[model samples]
Target: MPHDHEHPHSLLPPEPALRVKALETILTQKRLVDPAALDEIIDIYETKIGPRNGAHVVAKAWMDPDFKAALLADATAVVSELGYYGRQGEHMVAVENTDDVHNMVVCTLCSCYPWPLLGIPPTWYKSDAYRARSVREPRKVLADFGVELPVDTAVRVWDSTAEVRYLVIPQRPAGTDGMDEAALMALITRDSMIGTGLAIAP
Candidate 1:
């Protein structure tokens, strides 16, 4: 007979996260780990770092044509000038989305993402479904992500590898011309940089 009951572990967090939580709990009980410190670290990554760095780059590009040109020409050098370079981000390529072209990025192999600029890869980005579907049916994937590109817009999927990581610079929304870089940064989402979504409108 086939098993009818769900496995107990199925209800727990995914394997890696479950293991980390278990370890944290054990260390906390032993008074070896400071939960407060861990929380602060998590908060920093979740809010203050990663995607914010990419947003800053996007905002600057939106404001400065020279920087935008330089970013597209040599993403690694230009981005590093802003102090956002590190492992998993050594080689960077910036692709711009325009009225005629839409760029989407995916790691067909393991998730070789730009960790410094984008923070940790989202769980969805690392999934086998996304890795395969994003390349095979980019329009459908984008639609599922709530991004409906125009029929005339050409969708281009870039495969990210350890040698090169691509960042999508979403087209600046209309009426955002008066906004400053700080305000502009708020419009840039991580998903936009990943080419799965557009910049938030002001």
Candidate 2:
């Protein structure tokens, strides 16, 4: 004879926020360091310390037609082509921005970013204000970022979920007729991919 038995599934309960708060309280009580310093350190690490690999990828795509085709077809390979492949960006897709269609990226569920190319996402990108406001008012958000699109331009927003990530390949600016690769790279800023700023003309 057999008897019905139940086992507790939640052997270890989930208390991520509570644990974090407890650790934070302990640190604060100990006067380990200023809380604001953590933010500054993080900012410095992401911007100054980390690799600016995304700019390199963007510049490469702009300069090499074959590389651009490879990048658009398979971003991971293209990124690896320049020896900058990694965890989040093991997969990538290069979306081209056209005259009539503009591209923007957002991660609604979490800040799943393409770290291999873009490096660490900007602070504003991971902010709750940006997450909530982006989907609600995309055009307005773009406007707030000083990106004025033509009235006829259709804004296409890509939500970066768990599996997929995207990067925008802005159209090369006019007057770069004879600019070389190094010169072209100077025009590729992170803001350009986000559609907040157009590439500077050479």
Candidate 3:
């Protein structure tokens, strides 16, 4: 899902899921691609890793001020300490959202993302409309994602690049002081880390 450029979306028809299956079938028939490898890759993202991984990182940051400081300073090293850094996540930056500021991330050129901490990119993250609209009209774009900020809160859009991917550390929600890190993680959504959604309330 990572690319580096304002490359136009593929003209492939709207039925990409089916089209991909057809292509995969053909590649298997010709023995050009390994189905086992494909399955493994899919399974890895679906089960082994996903937003929950990032949620854990976020929850820890919410609980530990020192850790949060380290994360904001250098997310790569802080996350790597938990063994979540590789591939498209080589360079990482954590953007914290405050009471008066809301942050949103978009890859203007590509779907550059931190796959280790956040897993593979979501389907919409790879859409051209999102890439084009996020920077231009972030508040409106966020509203479409069901995120409506207060009138006084300033919206900050972060454009992720191949060199450095940004992760939004959404503000910790209220009524969570009694909750443990693991419990708090369950309230964190992938979109929250992507700056497209907010953490769920208890």
Listed per model in order, the count of residue pairs whose N, CA or C atoms clash below 3 Å is 0, 1, 0
Order the candidates by TM-score, highest first: 3, 1, 2
On residues 104-137, what C-alpha lDDT tens digit does candidate 3 reach at each position? 8888897888888888888899899899999999
Models sorted by lDDT, best on top: 1, 3, 2
Those runs of model 2 whose alpha carbons end farther than 4 Å from true positions after fitting are 1-51
lDDT of the candidates, in the order given: 0.91, 0.77, 0.88
Which residues of candidate 3, in runs, are more than 4 Å off?
A: 1-32
Please report the TM-score between candidate 3 and the true structure.
0.84
Candidates' TM-scores? 0.79, 0.74, 0.84
Q: Pick the candidate with the highest TM-score.
A: 3
Tell me which residue pairs clash in candidate 1: none
Collision count of model 2? 1
lDDT of 2 by residue, 140-181 (tens): 988787778889988888888766778888889888877877
- Report RMSD (Å) for each prediction in the order shown: 5.5, 8.2, 5.7
Cα lDDT for residue 164, candidate 3: 89
